[model samples]
Target: MKLPLHERIRSEIETAILSGTLRPGARLPTEHELMQRYDCSRMTVNKALSALAVAGLVDRNKRAGSSVAQPKVHSMVLDIPDLEQEVVRRGQRYRFQLSGREVKQPDPDYPEELQLAGNSDLLRLEGVHFADDRPLACERRLISLAAVPDIAAQMFDKISPGAWLLEHVPWTEAETRIAAVAADRTIAARLELPIGSACLSIERRTWRGADGITLVHQHFVGTAYDLVARFGPAKGSTGAEPQQL
Candidate 1:
């Protein structure tokens, strides 16, 4: 189905911004220029830019015209579900235990995904979560000290890292990636599963504005639990239909 002319224009510019074709602080084409390029009316161009500004993807001003905005925190609603609630919903008792905690500088060999310099300090946490006395998942997390200054002082053994971060930090954006892998010896022992057993792995990273907040890797016993997400269009909008995963 064809989108409205204004919506098509809006999507084109948004794609450029998100894809790094139009970087932060890059000036957008003037309304007159866009009208001429797309052969659309000025009102149509205005509508597209207005929508981008409202969405926090662009800045608009009479003096400076339009420019790509600083990266706002992007979030996926599927990332913040409570594991304890999920366990209870399945009629199992939930338990969490912290195995280790430390504060250290980022290693030079650290992966690029964390977006940190070698000198930056991080708070590292290792733990396991259980259902009915059986291990359900193993968690390893690293929190940026610059993003959450007091993170090292928190008692994550009493409150889970996820819960503590949700309560204390204001994240602007998050990303989650899910995959499957065979359990290695370390993970097998932690989750109380057989070596080479299939497992579900989730890698999640979150940020507050442009500052990296935390990165977590969770390995769940595959056969005992499933991950799910549901989505639907907003009210009064002719958007995509409801779907589940």
Candidate 2:
């Protein structure tokens, strides 16, 4: 099936932005220029640009034209979810069972900086979060053994690593990223979803003082969870208010 003309235009620009061809702060083509390039009407070009602006991928300026948006630094200071507590609050039984654990020394193949593997061993863990005997999320976590040596000895029989870390460790800084993805064979099997099923992925990292503590990536069925981030603009930035749909 062929996409609409406006959709095709949007996809082209979107691919450029994601592929780093159109970098952040880079000026995009003018509305008139896009109309000429796509051989579409001004309304079609405007529609494509409007959609990109709504997705936080571009900043539109009527007089100066459009440009790629800078990445957001603030995450609204919202409460990060501990799946166990979240499930229980929903009046359901919460359980976390570890399926795999290993102490790994990460190489350059991975994002070494975030893994905190330069001088420390990373305790890699794979697990699933359950609610009332149903799979809720799949997790892959890496704990810096150097930052929290005690985590090496703690056997997570009845508690999850995330919950345990939250209780025992104090973080000075943290970051979170949310993305949509299609479930692959591994994630599909773990979440009991069909291949290509839409999924939501949350990746987070925390640091204690100057040292990195842990990094975790979790995947949830798209229909099973809602991530609401209600935040205003940062103190000095002219960015728009952010909301997750």
Candidate 3:
């Protein structure tokens, strides 16, 4: 479906923000400039700018115009176990501290970006994933108790939901994507990092066969860790091992 004019503009602006093209405090073009660039009406431009303003991306003043918002540096990651384990195997012990957890009704104002629809009852887990006793990642996860009944009684301070699920529940499918973002005040405080620090964010959805999606895990990793992927030919084939960045 085609997005509304305002939404399209909002998405374009968001892309620019996420990609580092829009640095904080960099003034954006005047309303006329944006209208001409987007070939849309002034209302469309206003709506886009308003949406960005709500997201804390830019500051619009009567004479100052719009400027590139400071990029928040939150870490992004994917649920690739090998990489997570490798970080710990390198003599760095990984630990997770439970920041908060509860079951709540989905917020009506929740952004569609989460893709969590019609989910009134969700088990939420918020925590920080650490390496060598230092902050490594901050995570907020939503688990469907109806799908994973035992989750309500499980211990999470020790084993992560992702790891625990991998052991007890065999997942048949999953999808994930990574994005870089600047840390907001809330996340910055929990991760004990400076506001506007860069961090990697991961969004993942897991499914156990045809039983529908089981859980959605979100991660905000520190800038230190890198997410890497490897691929190869058949076992008998001759090829060099993938290089690590």
Q: Which candidate is the best by TM-score?
A: 1
Clashes of each: 2, 0, 22
Error of 1 at 68 (Å): 17
Error of 1 at 218 (Å): 0.9
Residue-level lDDT tens digits of model 2 in 1-245:
35679867876887787556888899999988888988889999999888778767789988889999886654334445566776776777878889999997875677854457548788999999887777788999999988777888878989999999867665535777889999999999999899999989889988643568888999988877877555554322122111121
| Alpha-carbon local distance difference test for all models | 0.76, 0.77, 0.64
Per-candidate TM equals 0.64, 0.62, 0.56
* TM-score of structure candidate 2: 0.62
Worst 10 residues of 1 by lDDT: 234-243
10 residues in a row with least lDDT, candidate 2: 236-245
Distance (Å) between predicted and true CA of 96, model 2? 0.4
**lDDT of model 3 at position 199:** 75
lDDT of 1 by residue, 28-99 (tens): 999999999999999999999987787678899998899999754422244466777677767777778999
Q: Per-residue alpha-carbon lDDT of model 3 for 1-245, expressed as tens digits?
A: 35678877876776676445766677788999989988999999999898777666778888888886653432332233632455466667777788788876656576431344234366788887777677777777776665566777876867877677656554434567678888889878877888988877777777543333344444454456655554433111112111222
Q: Which candidate is the best by lDDT?
A: 2
Name the candidate, 1 or 3, with the larger lDDT value: 1
